[model samples]
Target: MKDENIKKVLLLGSGALKIGEAGEFDYSGSQALKALREEGVKTVLINPNIATVQTSEGVADQIYFLPVQPHFVEEVIKKERPDGILLSFGGQTALNCGVELYRQGILEKYNVKVLGTPVQAIMDTEDRELFVQKLDEINVKTIKSEACENMEQTRKAAAELGYPVIIRAAYALGGLGSGFADNEEELVKLAEKAFSFSPQVLVEKSLKGWKEIEYEVVRDRYDNCITVCNMENFDPLGIHTGESIVIAPSQTLTNSEYHKLRALAIKIIRHIGIVGECNVQYAFDPQSEDYRVIEVNARLSRSSALASKATGYPLAFVAAKLGMGYGLFELKNSVTKTTSAFFEPALDYVVCKIPRWDLSKFRGVDKELGSSMKSVGEVMAIGRNFEEAIQKGLRMIGQGMHGFVENKELEIEDIDSALREPTDKRVFVISKAMHKGYTVDQIHDLTKIDKWFLEKLQHIIDIDEAMKKCNINTLDKELLRTAKVYGFTDFQIARAVGLEDELKSMRKASLVVRSRRKNYGILPVVKQIDTLAAEYPAQTNYLYVTYAGVKSDITFENDKRSIIVLGSGAYRIGSSVEFDWCGVQALNTIRKEGYRS
Candidate 1:
């Protein structure tokens, strides 16, 4: 049941799309508004992003084109008198503004209830010292760190923690003011910058080479908790997750390791009293199986958005319902429309998220990625295997590269240093080193990337090498099928097998390869991403195309007028969520006109 007392809800929006925080909040905030509308609640949305879906008419009862600042929010709260306000749906900008309003007694003065994860819970997770203390209460392992208030305290803390520590600003988003310092001079500089962003800084021992893992977890007010998805960062702990390539359903972890982390994530969220959706990040020593709870985001985060899309679970929608005093068992899964929202989602495919950077658009910017985020946006690709998913993600980033191995080689004087110190081109560098006969072990040692990922990348290279010796006429059906299974696009296969130069047109060569592949009975099949993994029958239209499957999940209605709408794939400099808003609006319009979209 919905909370009848919350007749009017004030929804804060993350204002404008920028680096570190973009598009994901627009997606989450739109879902929240939809959920509120479903519950017959009057929603007042405050967002200055004019091109977002949430700012569109009919999304909310009232739309305020105002910045999500404390003063503006306080003024709106006084005028609107909403019974509840949702802070967790927005990104850090709105969260920080809501916290400021709460600090100034504005919400209390106006008698507005903060919905979803309580303000105290958000503060506990935002403050490094308090987060550690909260986790300590449950005997959870956390990174060894000291919270410092000033430069003097930071220096002393770094000395005590020893050299090569990471400095993180508390209450910052997307690792906003965070970096690694190897010496006193670097520590002083990093700490000063961190102090500018936040009043508190955390100096912690650096787990540079450990695997960075994350879990998207959800909990209800009655203490029912479930882990929706777990992801592994292709880059190790030194790089920020926003800057690294990420894979969902953790490809490298053993069953024991996966379960251990999953259980711990549930424990931490339950202990911290996270009422809705949240994510926990970890740094795991792969060999020792020891781990550190890096941090927990007590809100719908970027990872949450990816997890929701990766699985067929609507995290933001369900989280909004949970915030309105509904139990997990009481709510139905919106995608399936036939199951309870309490169960964990099981995936039958892999998802890879590659970050998109517009570094070249600017002049003289350092391209190296570190603890702080530099990626403006990311693309999530789904496939039947790791190789296919990563390659699709690489292409989806709109970088002019054919899947991993066929890309142009970078001019690196030192391959070892290029791998050791990560840049946006590190993935391409790995492929280059492979071409130069670098062993998987050597690459893994230098890059600190997992051997499983390296081997899969090597497999792609091995296939390309095999194809180099064969022309389109000589390429057998088995070889073509194998390439397709591993995510080689027709264009990539054509280029590899000497068809590109022969035809002088990539489109013609790709069409020839496609025709041959179709004749050989190798074609892409549609697969549904039902949360149940086919254990139970579900009718979710959420689907993806993969070459590994034999049959499509849903039969096509050839008689109906079906219109395909293309979303703006991956937010970049020129395009962002505005095009996504356009696509969604088009789909809605098509549906209203009695057409399938």
Candidate 2:
């Protein structure tokens, strides 16, 4: 039955900000609360993270600064007696607690409906064995895996799957207690550790060299579905998506492959009866059409927030409406305002998301990129091309990298080893390899990154090489324009031509580059991310800057003065939720001062 009777809703918020799961949930949970309030529903939020803006005054009607475990949620339900409870807005923590509550019949006994994707569907996705069986029934391909209850069973399963398998513990978040085992010894060690976390372990064949791709799928209760966005991991399948450099509107796939994956994503969501947003991950081979469904996150995920920001689609807001019995066609696009939410977002630009790792803060920690997530935060950058987006994203990470080119001196001898091993600095190592005259084919053989992306990196190196040869005093407009087209910054160009040491010389070179670019009319124009690629008249304020074309889409109205507030970039250690709170307060202050923000 449609959930037309939901007048009061309880939202489970991600309790605390940690390494694997953080700020993304705050963004999502806040959006869900706003959507519920717009429908005139009284909202109760249960989140222990007092630092978040979601718990701020007026956001939630009733706020409980409690943990998001089953016991605490059951207490909230008993007291509040909410008409519905939303489990999808929170991270895996809330989903797990909700599932436990359903298993114990607390939700049933209390007459609370678990709105969004059902608890049974969540089980089918979370349980490795059940997930495999359900996908097999739908004829969707999955990697060969075995669920083992003990050490003996794990060894047997590993023997069946062969050497170099992956061990994953059931109910573990962020790929906790998951690792790749090359032989029996490694399998035994990883399995024992995994068993400590959960009762069952999944031993699966490793698709180490395959490309990791993901689709953000949204479905309504009426079976109408649409893919909001699709992303391609810059790093291959061995690394977790959270730790990998990701690009939106996949750069390597052919049209046929894109459509095939999109079809499978829709089919899986429909068969699983997911009534809201779900992220489906895939492992695909670039050489052939072979692919395997990795897994599905039947709730709002980190990828969901990235996809939403990259595409300018309010995923959590639409998902909340879907859970409240709204069909896809019935809702208007909040960004475009002229279109329905049923249409899939089309992009006219590229978005690059780079994971930020603060490994330097901790001592004796491994820096390898594996199935487990270690990134503290990530920054999203948009541009007219891949090179520009990646460079901007690197700068946005606040890691002192002006662009892709390395400023510090490193031994070229280490490039080959760095390429072979996956690390947080792999992209930099690849850049060094390209600068040292390594062929794309050789790097591809060593790193397993796609040749298309390798060529793009080579293009940046080629520009750097050209910059090295240019006379800084006589640098012309054409050269500056070309560099800007490939996403080169003035600081990067100055550093590239050996002017980084002498501050005066570097400043002079930067001024020359900036002046020449401006003289050549090479300034970036602001563009709106209307999700239509300018197919219709879009009335949205979501904007990005690109240097690709001559057209500008921004129209500044001088009639009303506006105060532009910049958000504190990606969340990181030592500087997090507090900045978000400040930004919100700034907007509130602007409104009180009678100015548009």
* Best model number under lDDT: 1
Query: Model 2 over residues 232-253: C-alpha lDDT tens digits?
Result: 9998888989999999989999
Per-model TM against the reference: 0.98, 0.97
Pairs that collide in candidate 1 are none
lDDT to native, each model = 0.90, 0.88
- RMSD per model, one decimal: 1.4, 1.6
Query: Clashes in model 2: which pairs?
Result: none
What's the true lDDT of residue 545 in model 2? 77
Clashes of 1: 0
